[model samples]
Target chain A: MMGLLETAKISLRSLWANKMRSGLAILGVIIGVGAVIAMIAVGRGASLQIESHISSMGSNILIIVPGTTTSGGVRMGAGTQQSLSLDDAIAIEEECSAVSHVSPELSGVAQVVYGNRNWSTGVIGTTEGMMDVHNWSVSSGRFLTDQDVRSSTKVAVIGETVAYELFGSANPVGEIIRIKKVPFQVVGVLAPKGQSAFGSDQDDVIFVPVTTAQKRLFGTPFPRMVRRISVKARDAESIYLAQEQITALLRQRHRIGPNQDDDFTVRNLTQAMEAAQQSTQAMTLLLGAIASVSLLVGGIGIMNIMLVSVTERTREIGIRMAVGARPRDIRLQFLIEAFLLSVIGGIAGIALGALLSQTLVLLFDWSTSISPSSILLAFGFSGFVGVFFGFYPAYKASLMDPIEALRYE
Target chain B: MALIEAEGVRKVYRMDGVTVEALKGVTFSINEGEFVAIMGPSGSGKSTLMHILGCLDVPTSGRYLLGGVDVGSLSRDGLAGIRNSKIGFVFQGFNLLQRMSALENVELPMLYGGVPSRERAEKALAALKTVGLEERKGHRPNQLSGGQQQRVAIARALVNDPPLILADEPTGNLDTKTSVEVMELLVSLNEEHGKTIVLVTHEPDIASFSKRIIRVLDGSISSDEVVIKHDGIA
Candidate 1:
C-alpha cells in the first residue's frame, strides 16, 4: 500500500507536469457528472412540485360528484338524478364506521359588494365541518356556529381573495357584503391558500350557512340542493373504507336497487395524492436512468484517456518496475489517480447541481428539494465508474514487459 | 560464496518470425566486493546479459543463483523481490523520474521495499551524501547536469543497501571528466562499502577502472581477464 502511494505520488507529479492535459481530462469528467446531476435534479424538482400540489389538496378527504354514463363509447354526464341528498350526508356521518366528517356544499357565481368595492367571485354555502374537512383556518373573527345554521342567519365568512379585493387594508369582520342583492355580515375571513394544482383559486370563494343560501339566496328546496358533498375519513389509511361506506349509504338512502347503475361518483383525495406521487416517482426514475447514460459516456472518456496515458507513460512504467516496483503496485497507482479524478469531479458536480437547483428556485419562484441520498448515490456511482473504467488500462500497464517498455521511444 | 552465479544461460529473441539469439550458453560468477566490467560493441548482447543479471529479464534456458536462491526458477514477484532487496540498478540514460526531485528519486527503491518514510528519507540523504549530491537533493533531473543526474541515479541504486549494483553504460551520456569521476565513485563504493559491481560498457578506458574485464562478441564471452588491483579511492 505504501509503495502504491509512492507510485501514485509520482504519477500525480507527472500529471501535474503537463497541467493542460490533466485539466482537460478532469474537465471531461466534470461536465459529464455535472450535466447528469443537473438534469436529474431539475426533473426531480418538477416531479416533487407536482406531487406536493396534489398532496396539499387533502389526504383523507373524498368528493362525490354527479357521474357520466357512456353511450356508443362516448361518455356524458348523466345530470343529477336525485341520487344524493342532505340526508345521505347525515346518514354517512352518523352510520359509516370510517367516516369522520361530512359537509354538503352548494356553489354559485355571484357578485359580492362591500362599501364601494364589488367583485364577482365563487360563493359556497356549507356548514362549519366544511372548514375542518378542507383543513382551512379562519385568520380573523369566527366561523358560523350551529345556532347560525339553525336560525338560518344571513352571516357569511369571506375567502381571503374576496376580502382583499373588497376590504383591501380594512378588516372585513362585522362588515356587510351583498351577495346576489342580499346583505350578509362577514363573520370571518379565511387564511390564504394560494392556488391548487388545477389552477383553481382556493381562497376566491365565500362561505355562508347552507340553509340560508339554499332557502333565502338560491330559493332551492332542501332535498333538491347542493352541487357536491365532501367527506373526510378518520385518517389517510381509512380513506378507501370511508369511500365504500359512503357509496353504500348514499345508494341505500336513494332507494337505488343493486342492479341499477349508480348516479354518483366517489373520488378519494388520497387516491389522487397516490396517483400524483406514483407519476412523480416514475418521472424521477426515468430521469435518473437517462442521467446514467451520461455517466456511461464519462466512464468511456476515462477509459480512453487512461489508455492514452498508459501508452504515453510506458517508459515511466518501465523505469518504476526496473527500480523494484511490483506489477500490482504499478496498476494500483494508475487506479488511484483515476479514482481521484472521478471523486473530485463527483463532488464538484454535486455542488454545481445544488447551486443551479437553488438558483432556479430563487430566480423563477419554483419549488425544489434535493435529497441527501441522491448526492451519496452520485458520488458512489462516479467512484464505481472510475474503478470499472480504470481497470483495463491499469492492467495493461502492469502487464507490460519491462525490457520492451524501457526500449520504447 | 559468489553473490551471483550464471550457468549455461541463453536468451533468444523472435523478431519478424526469425529467431535471434541474444545470449548463448554464457557462464560466469561474481563474488562479494568484486568490481567487474563487461565490454562489447552494439548488438554484442552485453545489455541483454546485464538485464538478465539484474533480474529484469529471465533467461530462456539456464540457472541463475543469487545468494544460494535459484532466481531462474522463481516467479515474477519473486524476481521483483530479489530486485528490490538484493540488486540495485543504474542506467546509461540516468533514468531518474523526470518529475521527481533528486531526493525522491533516491527514495524510490526503499519505497518499493516498504521502508518507513522517515527511514527512507534518512537513507536517501545518506546515499545522496555518498555521491556528494546532498546539497542538490531538491533539484529535479531536468534541473541537474547530466553528471549530477547520473549521481542521483547512483544514489537511488544504493539507497536499498543492496548487495549488488548493476550499471549499464552508466557514463555513456557524460563528458570524459565526468565519466572518470563516476568511475572513481563506483570503484570507491565497491572498495569502501563492499558492494559487488557489474557494469556493462563499450569504453576501454572505463573498463580499466574495474579489477576484472569480460568481453562479449557474437552473443558469447570472448575473453575474461583480471587487471591491476589498485587500492580504490575512499
Candidate 2:
C-alpha cells in the first residue's frame, strides 16, 4: 500500500486538475452544512432572547390570584372572588421570612383620551413599591410616591406605547388624560421594555395609586379588596420557600379548615419560566433536525459524483494496477479524495453560515448566535458523510479487473 | 533455475456459461539478462499469456515460477509485492497518468513500492535520464509528443530497476521513425543494463531487436529461436 501522504498527494493532484468538477461536487455539501449551521444559530438566538426576557420580567416573582368562589351554587373562576386584600399583602411582607417585598394590585381595562386620540390599555393600581417589585423604572417623571397613595392623588404613570399613542413624540408628563371619563394627571412615562415571551405588549399599561383607583375610578363597595398580590423573594433560590410561606399564611389568615381549600393560590413564576424554556429548546432541536435533512441529500450527491469519477477514471485505475498498486491503495486514493472534498467543503460552509447569520441579524434584525459545539458537530458530520458516501465508489474502483479496465476507452 | 519457468500453464475464461481457453499448456523459460519477444497476430492469446507472466492475472492451471518463487502460491498482496519489486510493465498506449507531470508519473511505481520521497525523486530522475527525457520531466502527457510520452512510460517502468521489463507493443502508437527509436532504447537497456526484457508485438522488425523470438498461433507456441546477432550480448 502507498503511504497515506502519497495517496493524498495523488488525490489532491487529480482534484486540482479537474477544478470545476471538484467544485461542483463539493457545492452540495457547502450549502447543506451552511443552512444547518445558520438555522441552529437563529433558533438558539431566539430561545436565548426568550429566556432573558422571562427573567427580566422580574426575578424570583410569585403571583397570588384569588381562588374560585361559589355564589348561589354557581362557581366563579380565579381572580373573580375578590378574596385578597391590601392587609394580606402587608402581612405577607412583614411576616414571611422568605418574602422580600409585596404589592397588592388592582387592575382593569380603560380607554384613555388625550385631546382627539383615544387608546384602550390596561390600568393597574398599586402602592409605591410596585415599580421595584416589577423591576420597572420611569424615564421622564417620578414614580408614584407613598404620599400619593395616602392622599388618594389622581396621578398616573404611562407606559411607552400608551405615551406614544396619546401624545405622539411629545412628552406626556404633567398632561391630563381622562380615564373612563375621570381626568387624571400623568406623573411619568415608563421606558420601552419591548415584547414578552408570551407575545404580550409589555409597554402598553398605565399605573396609578391603589387608593385613588378604588375611590375615584372603581368606587367599589369592598374598600380593602384587591384583585391580586404580587410578591418578590430575596433571591431565585428562595422563591419556592416564599411561595410555601405565603400559602400557609394566607390559608391561616382566611381561617380555612384542614379539609377545605384556601381562597387564594400562589403561582411560582420560575416554574412557568422553566416550562417556557423547555418548549423553546424543543423548537431549536426541531429546527436543527429539519436542517440536517439537506446534509443527507448532500451526502447522496457526493456518492453520485464519486461513482461517476471512478467510472471516468477506469483507465487510470488499470494503469495504477499494472504498475503494482494494491487494491487497497487504489481504494485509499479515491477515498482520500472524497474525504478532502467534504472537509474542505465543511470549512467553507462554516464561514458562509456565519456570514448568513450576520446577514439575518442585519437584514431582519433577528438575533443569531453560532455556538462552537454546533460548528464542530457540523464539521465532523461532513467528514463522516465523505467516508460513508465515498466507500462504494472507491470499492468499485478497487475491484475493477485490470485486463478489462486497461482495454476501456 | 531460469529467471522465469512456466510448465503446463493454461487459462480458461467463463463468459455466459461458455468457456474459452486463451492459453493451453504453454511451456517456456528465459535466463536472466535475456531479451525475448513473444510474437503473434490478434486473438492468438499472446496478451493473456503476458498477463499471466506479469502476475496481473492468475492462471486457471499452471506451474509458473518467477525468480525461483512459485507465482501460483502467493496471495493477492504477495503477488502485488512481487510485481512491485520484480517486474516493470510498459503498455501499447503508453498508459501515463495524464494529470501528473512526467516526473510524477515516473515516481508512481516507486510510490506504490513504498520508496521514500527523496530516494523516489532521485531514482525517478535517473530513470528519466536513462530514457533520455530528463529535460521533459516537468511536462504533462498532453504537452509531450507520442514518442516522448512512451519514453516517460518507459522511465516509469524503469524507476524501480526491476529485473524483468514487460513491454506490450511499446511503440504501437508511434510512427515508424519513433517506433525504431523506442525499439533501440529497449535494446540498449537490455544490452547496457543487463535487464531481462519480454517484448510482445506482431511487427517482425520490432521482434528483430530482441535476442530470442517466440511465435504463438492458436493458443500454442509455434516457434522459439535465437536471432543471429551482429551486436553480441552484454
Candidate 3:
C-alpha cells in the first residue's frame, strides 16, 4: 500500500515540476469555481434585497381594496366601488383577535405647492396606525396622534422625496404646504424607504389624517367611506386567519348571502411578497446552474490535461512499476495529481470570487453576499470534479503494460 | 531450491491481428548466487525472457517460477510483491526519474516495499556506497554521467536487498570505460554480495563478465554455456 503522504509528496513534486502546464490546466477550474461563487453571491444578494423591501412594506400585513363595480355592463376595475370604509377597518381591528392594527386610506394623485416649488405626488389620508402597519417611523418631529385624526387637523407627515421636493435641504416640519390650494402644516418627515417591489418610488408620498382628507384636501363621494384598508395580523402565522376573519366579518356586515359575489377583496401582501421571493429564489438557482456548467467544463479540462500527462510519462510509469510499485500505487499518484489541481483551483477561485463580488459592489453598487454554504459547495464540488474527471486517466495509467510502456519512445 | 525457473515458457504477441511468437517453449533454471547473461540481437526474444523472469510480464504458456513459486499464476499485485521483494531491475536507459536526486532514485524500490523513510534512506545510501557513488547521491540523474545514472538505478534495485538483480543491457548507453566500471560493479555485487544476476546483452565481451551465458536465436535458446572467466585483482 502506498502511504498517502508519499503519494501526495510525489504528486506535488511532479505538478510543481511542470508548473506552467499545471497552471494552464487549473485555470479552467479557477474560472469555473470563481464564476459559480460570484454568480451565486449576486443572486443571493438580489433575493436578500427583495426580502428587505418586503419587510419595509411590513410583515403579516394585508391590504383590502374594493371589488370592481360594473356600470351598464362596462366592468370597472378593483377599487372603483365604494365598498370599504373607515368604520369597517375599525370593526376588524376591534373584533378579530388575529387583526392587530388597521389603517384605512383615501388616496389620490394631487399637486402640492410649498414656497416657489410645486410638485405632483401621491396624497394619502390615513390614520395614525398607518405607521405601525407599514413599519414606518418618523425621522424628525412626531407622527400624527389619535387626537389629530379626531379633530380633523390640517396637518401632514411628508415622505423623504416629498420633503426634498417641497423644502429642499431645509426642515419641512412646522412649515405649511398647500394641497389643491388648501394650506396644511407639516408635522414630521417619514423615514426614507427606497423603492417598492414593483419598482415604484416609496418615499414620494404625503400622509394626512383621513378626516382631514375627506373634509379639506380631497372630498370623498360618500361619508365614512375609504378606498382601501391596511390590516396587520397579530403574527405572521395568523395572516391567513386574519384575512378569513376579515372576509367573514365584511360579508356579514355587507349583508351578502352564501355564494353571493363579494363587494371587496382581501389581499395578503405577505403571500404576494412570498411569491415574488420564490421567483427570486428560482432565479438564483438558475444562475448557480449556469455557473455549474462552467465548473463542469473545468473538470473536463483537468481530465484532458491528465490524459496528456499520462501519455507523456508512460516511461516514468514503467520505471515505477519495474521497481515493484503496484498498479494501485501508480493510480493513486495520478489521482492525487488531479485532485490537487482542482483543490488548488478551488481555493484560488474562492479568493477570486470574493474579489469579484467586492469589485461589483464597488463599481456598480450591487449588493453581493457570499454565503458559507456557497463556498463549501464550490470547494467540495471542485474536489469531486477532480476525482471524477481524474478517474479515467488514472485507470488508463494503472492498466498499462510495464514492458510495453518502458519500450515506448 | 532454484532461485529462478522457466518451464516451456512462451510469449506470443498479437498486434493488428498479426500473431508473433516472441518466445518458444524454452526451459531454464538458475540457483542462488549465480551470474547468468542472456545474449541476443534485436527481436531475438532476450528482452521478453528477461521481462518474464523479472515478473514484469507473464508468459503466454508454461510455468515461470521464482524461488519454487509459480509466478505465472500470481495476481498482478502478487507479481508486484514478488518483483518488489525479490528482483532489482537495471534497464539500459538507467530508468531513474530525471528530476529526482540520485538518493531519491535509489530510494524507489524500498519506497514500494513500504520501508520506513529513515531505513529506506540508510539502505539507499548504503547501496549507492556499494556502487562507489555515495557522494553523488545529492545530484539528479541529468546532472550525473550515464555511468553514474546507471549506478543510481543499480542502487535502487539493490535497496530492498532483493535475491535477484535483472539487467537489460545495463551498460548499453555508456562508453567503454563507463561500461567496464558498471560491469565491474555488477560483478562485485554478484561475487562479494552473493546476488543472483540475470543480464540481457548482445556483446560477448560484456557476457564474458558473467559465470554462464545463454544465447537466444529466432525465439529459441541456441546455446547455454559456462564462460571461462579471467581473474580480476579486485
Candidate 4:
C-alpha cells in the first residue's frame, strides 16, 4: 500500500489535470449542502421565534379556566360551568406550596372614547399583581396600586397602541377615557410589547381594576368573572411541581372526585412553550430529512461523474499501474480525489449557507440562530457522501485489466 | 544465470467471443548486459511478447524467470514488485504524465517503490542528466518536443537503476534524425552502464542498431541474428 500522502499527491494531480470537470462535479455537493443548511436554519429561526413568544406569555404561569362536564362525553376548551372564582386565586396564592404569585384576569372587547376619537380594544380587569406577573412596565405615570383596586376606583392604564390612537401627539396619561359610557382616568400608558407570534397586537389593550369593572362598568356581581388565572413558579424546575400542587388544590376546592374531571383547567405557560418547542423540533427534523435527499442526489452526482472520469482516464490508470502502482494505490488515488472534492464543496457550502441565513434575517427581518452542531453535521455528512459515492468508481478503476487498459487507445 | 529466460510461452486473448492466440510456444533467453531487439509486423505479436516479458501481462502458459526467480507463478503484487525493482519500461508514445514536469515524471517509479523524496529527487536529476535532459527537467511533457519527451521517459526508466530496460518501439514517434539520436543514446547506456536492453521495433534500420535482433513471424521467432557495426561507436 502506498502512503496516504503520495496517494493524495496523485489525486491532486489528476484533479488538476481535469480542473473544469472536477469543479462542475463539486458544484452539486456545494448547492445541496448549502440548501440543507439554509432550510434548517430558517426552520430553527421560526421555531425559536415561536418559543420566545410563548415564553413572553410568562413562565411558571398557570392559566385557570372553568371546565365543562359534558353529558355527551366530550371535553372542550375551558369549561361551560362557572366554577373558577377570585377566591380560588386568593386561596392558591395563600395555600399552594410551589406558588410564587397568582393573579386573576377578566378580559373583554370594548369601545373606548377619548375626547372625539373612539376605538375598539381589548380591556382587561385584574388586580395590581397582574403587572408584576405579566412583566408589564408603565411608560408614564404609575400602575394601579392595591389601594386603587380595593377602593373600587374608576381608573385605567392604556396600552401604547391605544394611547397612540386616542392622543396621537399628546400623552394620554391624566386623560379621561369612556368605557361603556363609564368615565375612567388613564393613570398610566404601557410601553410597547410589539406584535406577538400569532399576530395579535400586544400593545392594543386597556387595564382596569376587577372590582371597579364588575361594580361600576358592567354592573353585575362577579360579572364576566375571571376568565383565566395567571401563576408564577419560583424557577424553571419548580414549574411541574407547581402545576401538580395547583391541580390538586383546585380539584379539592371544586369537590372533584376520582375519575371525574375537574371543573377548571390550569395550564402553565412553560407547558405551552415546551409543546411549541417540540413541534419546532419536529419541523427541524423534517426539514433536515428533506435536505438529506439532496445529499443523496449530490452523492449520485459524484458517483455518475466519477464513473465518467474513470472511463476518461483509462489510459492514465493503465500507465500508472504499469509503472508499479498497486491496485489498492489506484483505488486510494481516485477515492482521495473524490473525497477532496466533497470536503472542499462542504466548506464552501457552509459559508454559503451561513450567508443565506444571515441574508434572510437582514432582508426579511426574521430571527435566525445557527448552531455550531449543524455546521459540523453538514461538513461530516458531505465527507461521508464523498466516501460513499467515490467507492464504486474507484473500485472499477482499480479492477481494470492493465493489459486491456494499456491497449485501450 | 541469464537475466531473463522464457521457455514455451503462450498467450491467448478473447475478442468478441473469439479466441485468438497472440503468442505460441515462444522460447528465448538473454544474459545480463546484452542489448537485444525483437522485430515483427503489426499482427506478429511482438508487442504482446514484450508486454509479457515486462511483467505487464501474464502468459497463459510459460516458464518465465527474471534474475533467476520464476516469475510465471508470481502473484499480481509479486509481479508488481518485480516490475518496480527489476524492470524498466519505455513506450513508443513517450507516455509521460502530462501534468508532471520531467523530473517529477522521472521520480514516479522511485516514489512508487517507496524511496524517500530527497533521494528520488537526486536520482531523478542524475537520470535526466544521463539522458542530456537535466536542463529541461522542469518542463512538462506538453512543453517538450517528441524527442525530448521520449528522453524524459528514458530518464524515468533509468531512475530506479533497474537491471533491465524494455523499450517497445521507443523511436516510433520520433523523426528520422531524432530516432537516430535516441538510438545512439540507448547504445551508449548499454555500452557505458552495461544495462540489459530489450527493444521492440518494426523498422529494419531501428533493429540494425541493436547488437542482436530476433524476428517474430506468425507468433514464433523466425530468425535470430547478430549485427556487427564499426565506426558507429563514439
Residue A331 displacement in candidate 3 (angstroms)? 0.8
Off by over 4 Å in 3: A67-82, A94-100, A106-132, A136-221, A233-265, B15-19, B231-234
> Which candidate number would show the highest lDDT if scored against the true structure?
3
Candidate models: Cα lDDT each: 0.84, 0.89, 0.92, 0.85
lDDT of 4 by residue, B1-234 (tens): 599898998999999999999999799999999999999999998988998889988889978888998888887778878888888888998888877899999998887799988888999999999999999988999999999999998998888889999999999899999999999889898999999999999988887788899999888999888878655533
Please provide, for model 1 over B1-234, each residue's C-alpha lDDT reduced to its tens digit, 9 standing for 90 to 100: 799889999999999999999999899888989999999999999989998998988899988888888888887777788888899898998888877889998998888889999999999999999999999999989999999999999999999999999999999999998998999899899999999999999988888889899999989999999987655432
A175-269: candidate 1 lDDT, tens digit per residue: 89899989999999988888888788899989998878887677664545676789889988888888888888877776679898778888776
> Runs in model 4 with CA error above 4 Å?
A1-3, A59-61, A66-83, A91-102, A106-196, A199-220, A223-225, A231-273, B223-234
lDDT tens string, model 3, B127-230?
A: 89988899998999889999988888998888888999999899889998989999999999999999999999998888889999999988999999998767
CAPRI-wise, candidate 1 is medium
lDDT of 3 at B85: 94
Q: Which has the higher DockQ value, candidate number 1 or candidate number 3?
A: 3
True contacts kept of each: 0.64, 0.70, 0.80, 0.48
lDDT of 2 by residue, A1-409 (tens): 6889888888898888889988988888898889889989998898788778765677788999999988889997887777888889889988999988888898889999999999999998898778778888989998999899889899999999999999999989999999999999999998778788677999999999988888877765589778989998998889888988998999999998999988888988867787777887887788778877887788888888889899999999998888888889889999999999888888998888899999999999999899999999889999999998999999999999888889999
